[model samples]
Target: MAIICRNTIEAINHLAFRLDLGPDDVVVTTVVEHHANLLPWRRYAKVRYVECNPEGTFEPDAVAGALRGNPHPKLFAVTGASNVSGWLPPVGGLIQLSHEAGVPVLVDAAHLAPHRPLLAAADYLAWSGHKMYAPFGAAPLVGPRRTFAMGDPFLAAAGRSTWCRSTRCSGTLPQSARRPDRPTSSERWPSAPLPVPSQPSGGRRSAHNEHLASRLRSGLGAIEGSRVLGPGPLVPTLPVASFVVEDVHHALVAARPAAEWGISVRHGRMLLRPPLPASLARD
Candidate 1:
């Protein structure tokens, strides 16, 4: 079963709430997740992070260890790919491992969706459409039917109401069924009349991205003061390379290109804030 959401963050929060998580419950997740995936779980449960190695990668054993340590983890929240390192985890095997341990898995595919086929085998999946060049404000949350069938809606609003008895009200089955008004985005932004650029096939795009990433890594490595983060391009990854130049503030590094060449570069923490694993370091 699936339902539309205002965005991937909302979808994640809804999933977290529906899990019936609490302070006593444990959630096993990795260190390399985006804040959207991590914060929602932290709000309701005690999160056990499976720390990454220096290369920003973790083995199934690490996750297994986390599960064993927790004894009865309610869920395993994991990223399909790292937005910072561009590293793709073995999500299929990870999902299987969690299932074998009697834990449900939620695969945060916000970054992975635009690059590769999704891990459909996972118990729950969530991703944003904007990453794939679709308009913002639309995301999808897909999961088992029974989970959402009987729960009180995450956002108790007008559209979700099934019945009203003076002061008491009931919500619809598949809680998000009436919540998202995604179609309104098109209507609201009709003035922005343009289509997304055409793209190559998935296989072709992936290959091109890999080649481009390799060249980017090589160029950055040659720069006298620059240091690229994560494993080398020889390691399979998406077309994302983060780097830093010695004796330069990241803001200055980001500003020079946009001012001089009209090339916008993102800098700063990229949302991997403090209290996170050292391996998932700031770029």
Candidate 2:
């Protein structure tokens, strides 16, 4: 079953709440997640973080260690892709590893879903609509019904009730709604078809983005004081690139171009902190 949330934050929060985590519970996660995936679990459970390499990538051994080493691990949370370095983790393999260790897996696919297929192997999955160019907030938390069968939703409201009779009510699982719930609208969001990389136009778009990223890397590297971070362009990644120019503040790197030449870029430490050096946190 799926619950439509206002965003990935709420979706993940709902999942974390329904899991009924306690202070003694441990959650195994990686350093590559956005705060949406990381913070929710922190609210209730002790977190065991799996560290990544300089390139924002981690091996299955790391996951294995966390799963086997941590006490009371109830879930394994991971990002399908990194928003900062555009690194794609081996999610399917990670999910299998988690299962073997008897921990369910939750894949935060907000960044990855826009570019590739969703990981079907994940026991629970969450992704946002804004990342997919959807018009408004709509994110889905998908998982087994039993997890949500008994809990009061993270948020309780009139909209969540399928029907109300006297003091008794039948409500949606883990209510992640804002206003009066319209099942049709929320249900349609996840079912909506997205462009697949295998399609002709999608192939072209992918090629174009890769070409752009390659050129971006080459261009930035050629600049006297600048260096591109993360894996080289040959690595399969989203079109995103992060870099730094020596002796320049990251804010200045992003602002100058946008103000002077209409070139918009983003900067600052992405929510995932460690992989990015304090100096090279521009995108």
Candidate 3:
């Protein structure tokens, strides 16, 4: 089943309610997750962060260790891709580990869906249409129907009802009449159709982006006093990269180029700070 919302944040908030998380329940998540993935769990449950390597990637052992330690984990939440470093973590491996421990996984695919296909093993997936070149204000949370039916409704809208009465109402509505009571998967999605382009076209775009990103990485590495964050060569990554210049604030680096050469780049903490060892930070 799918539940449509304004954005990924709203979808996560709704899922949090459905989970009925409390102080006793822990949610295992990675340190490299976006605020959209972390904040919701933090607000509703006891969050146990699985530390990622300096490159914003995690090994299967790390995830398994976290799951083993948390005896009462309600869910495992992770991002399909790092929004800042553009690193695509091993989501399939993580999901497998979580499932072995009897835990469900929620994937925040807002960044990954636009660039790569999602892993089918994920228990729940959330993405925004705007991230994939569609108009803003439409995001969907896809998961099992039983999951939604197991919890309280996220909202108290009139359309959620099967019948109404002025005084006391006595009987259940027929299944056909109660169609509006539970929204079908199709009705929960955007009204407009989303078509997938040919695989050849997508492959061409991916190849081109990879070429440009490789060049960008090489060029940035040659520059004096530059430090790039995330995994080394041959790792699948988005066309995006994040770096910091030695002895310079990120804000200044972003501002100077835009002001002088009309070049735009994102800076700051990127909403989530990955754990970096002292040795890596010193570099």
Best by TM-score: 1
User: Runs in model 3 with CA error above 4 Å?
Assistant: 157-202, 269-283
Q: For residue 193, give model 2's deviation from the true position in Å.
A: 4.9
Error of 1 at 178 (Å): 12
Model 3 per-residue lDDT tens digits across residues 1-283? 7787778888888787778787668899888888788878877777888887788788878888888884658899999989877888888888988999999999999988877777889999998877766666678888887677643346555666545686522136553454322553333455442435543446776687677767777777778999887877578678788888988888998998899989898887543356645422221
Candidate 1 residue pairs that clash: none
Candidate 1 lDDT tens digits, 1-283? 7666667788898898888877789889988898889888888888889999988889899998887774499999999989887888899999988999999999999988888888879999998877776667667788987777665667666655655577766643355453332223222221221223476656887898788778878887898999888775678888787888988889998999899989889888544445655432222
Model 3 C-alpha RMSD to native: 6.5
Greater-TM-score candidate between 1 and 3: 1
TM per candidate? 0.84, 0.81, 0.80
lDDT of 3 at 237: 78
- Model 1 misplaced stretches (Cα beyond 4 Å): 165-167, 171-198, 269-283
Tens digits of per-residue lDDT for model 2, 1-283: 7777777888898788888888779999987788888888777788898988887778899899999984859999999988877778888889998999999999998888787778888999999877776645678788887676665536555555555677656544334432232233444464443754465455676677677767777887888998787776678767777887878888999999999999989887534245644322221
- Indicate the residue-level lDDT of 21 in model 1: 77
